[model samples]
Target: MEFFYFLLIGAISGWLAGQLWKGSGFGLIGNIVAGIIGGIFGGWLASKLGIGGGGLLWQIVIAAGGAWILLFIISLFKK
Candidate 1:
């Protein structure tokens, strides 16, 4: 299903973002949440900026970028 693919991409993106961002993700659930939200943000950003996010790899890349940014913003507020 489309939802499953989205979740899969989100999980991978979140995990990768957490790993790259010094492991700040809450846990599996947190990562999933972050990734899913990040995917939305990324898709929105891509659309607004006229960037292509058509393929699975592109979606992952965009989601990861968005997740990293989201983590960075959260850390800033938490500190």
Candidate 2:
């Protein structure tokens, strides 16, 4: 279903962001939360940047990028 696909994307995005960020990986639930939120942020950012009509792959890329940014901000506050 579409919902499952969304969740799958979020999980993948979160996991990918975590791996790429290094020492900033949140656990499963956290990853899901971050990914979902990041997806929203990414979508907003993409729209603001005039990037639209992206497919699933583009969505994942944007989501991962957003997740990475989110983690980076959190890391800053933690320091």
Candidate 3:
């Protein structure tokens, strides 16, 4: 269903972000959480900035961007 698809996207997005940023992964579950949260942040950012992407692929792109930013912030704090 749509809900499940969103969760899948979140997991993938988080995993991708973690891979992109070395040593920022928090395992599978944590990644999922971060991605889901990041998705929201990304969507909001896109909306505020008047940017948009259509379809599922676009959603993943937006989420990945957000997840990466989130991980980057987390890494800064961890340091």
Winning candidate number (lDDT): 3
Residue pairs clashing in model 3 are: none
> What TM-score quantifies how close candidate 2 is to the native fold?
0.86
Off by over 4 Å in 3: none
The digit string of per-residue lDDT tens for model 2 on 1-79 reads 9888888888889888888878557777787778878888888898999987668899999998888888888889978
lDDT of 1 by residue, 1-79 (tens): 9999989999999988888887666677777778888988988898899997578888999998888888888879989
TM-score of each: 0.88, 0.86, 0.88
Over 4 Å off in model 1, which ranges? none
RMSD of each: 1.3, 1.5, 1.4
**What are the Cα lDDT values of the candidates?**
0.84, 0.83, 0.86
Question: Candidate 2, 63: how far from true, in Å?
Answer: 0.5
Q: Write the per-residue lDDT of candidate 3 for residues 1-79, one digit (tens) a residue.
A: 9789888889889888877777557777777888998998999999999898888888998998999899888878988
Q: Model 3 — which ten-residue stretch has the worst lDDT?
A: 19-28
Q: Which 10 consecutive residues of model 1 have the lowest summed lDDT? A: 23-32
lDDT of model 1, residue 28: 71
Which regions of candidate 2 fall more than 4 Å away from where they truly are?
none
